[model samples]
Target: MTNVIFTVGNDMRADDGAGPFLAALLEADPAAGWEVIDGGASPENHTHRIRALSPKRVVIVDAADMGLAPGEVRRIDEDCVARHFLITTHAIPLNFLIDSLRETVPEIVFLGIQPREIVFMAPMTDDVRRGVAALHRTLVDGVGIDSFPGIAE
Candidate 1:
């Protein structure tokens, strides 16, 4: 089963760039069974490609306002996604996007990293960078979704 990853964010916005930055890293040295995409701020733009991949697992990494401390990461489950309207800069709402993708992908994982500063022309915060690195490590180690830190229960 192909593993697909979609990183969504706006580089111009500080910590919001986490998705793009991580995408670049994974693209450079992608996992053995993974296809990485930099979905940028509009993940909806890449839905066609995602559908074409016919992946068994789809992982989406994005900065979210989960009311946690800066740099914290959490796995937002489908139920939470349906219940809360997250603040995103995508053309289509995240809930709808994920729901549409769910029809094709067997499993979808939404990794939400708490962003400290999301401002124009600002660099990513140190804490968030560290968090991204940790996430990258976990992916490389092939850890299960249950192993990720701050995962929603």
Candidate 2:
């Protein structure tokens, strides 16, 4: 069964670059049983590609405002996404994207990294960078998402 990670964010934005940053790391040193897709700020555009993969599981990573501290990472519940992600940079909401791929992808996970700021052309915040690094380590080590901390209620 193929497991895919779809990262969503804008590299030019500060904390919003968390997804792309992790994508780059995973691309450099990929993990077994996992495929990395840098969805950038327009993950909705990649639904066709994801459908083609017919992955067993799909993980979507993005910077979200969850009213948590900067750099905080959480496995966001699909239903709570709208409540927590009040502001989004993407053209289409993530929930819609998830729904679109649900038929092809049996399982879907949404990982959110709290952003400190999202200024255009600004570099990623140190705290968010650390979060990305932690996620990278977890993926590369094949430790599984269960070992990662935080799960939004």
Candidate 3:
């Protein structure tokens, strides 16, 4: 089954850039089992491509204000998306986007990296960068998605 990965964030906003940074890294030398998309702030823009891919699973990576230490990575409970985190700055909300995508993708998962700072024109923090690097290695190394921390099987 095909697997798709969507990284969403605003590069202009400090740690929020983690998504695209990781996307670029994965894209440069993509792994065999996944298709990486630099979804940016408007992930909804890629709905067509996702539908076209007919993936069985979709993993979304984004920087969220999850009230955790900076660079901490965890699988956000789908039920808590709206309440506990600062989602994308796009017009469409992340929860709605995920619900809509569920029509095509059977399994949808979210990986959230806590942001140290989201100030405009700032660079990504070292903490978030390290987290991104670690995630990149796990995915590239073919670790099972079930192995992702904080995600309930």
Candidate 4:
């Protein structure tokens, strides 16, 4: 079964760039099997492409304000996504995108990384960078998301 990763964020923004940064790393890795889509600030625009891929699983990565320390990562449950993602830069609600994808994608996971800053054109904070790098390593190593640091419920 095919698995796809949809990264949502604006690279121009500081920590909000986590998604895209992770996307770049995954794309360059020759051993990575999942398709990576850097949705940038408008992941809704890529809905058609994701549907076309017909992936069995779709993982959405984004910078979220989960009230946690900077660089913390968590698997945000669908029902709790809106609660944690308050400062969104996307054009539409992520929950909406998830709802739309549910029709075609059997499984959807939202990976949220707590961001320290999201200023426009600012460099990503070290904390968030480390979080993104950890996530990248987890993906490239084919490790379960549950094994990632700060992933506990």
Q: Write the per-residue lDDT of candidate 3 for residues 8-51, one digit (tens) a residue.
A: 98999899888999899998868778998888988889888888
**RMSD, candidate 4, Å:** 2.0
Q: If ranked by lDDT, best first, what sequence of candidates would result?
A: 2, 4, 3, 1
User: Residue 10's C-alpha lDDT in candidate 2?
Assistant: 97
Question: Positional deviation of 25 in candidate 1, in angstroms?
Answer: 1.2
Pairs in clash, predicted candidate 2: none
Q: Which has the better TM-score: candidate 1, or candidate 4? A: 4
TM-score of 2: 0.94
lDDT of 4: 0.86
Task: State each candidate's clash count.
Answer: 0, 0, 0, 0
Alpha-carbon runs more than 4 Å astray in model 4 = 149-153
Q: Which ten residues in a row have the lowest lDDT in candidate 1?
A: 144-153
Query: How high is the lDDT of residue 92 in model 4?
Result: 91
TM-score of model number 3? 0.93
Off by over 4 Å in 1: 82-85, 149-153
Total colliding residue pairs, candidate 1:
0
lDDT of each: 0.81, 0.86, 0.84, 0.86
lDDT of model 3, residue 88: 55
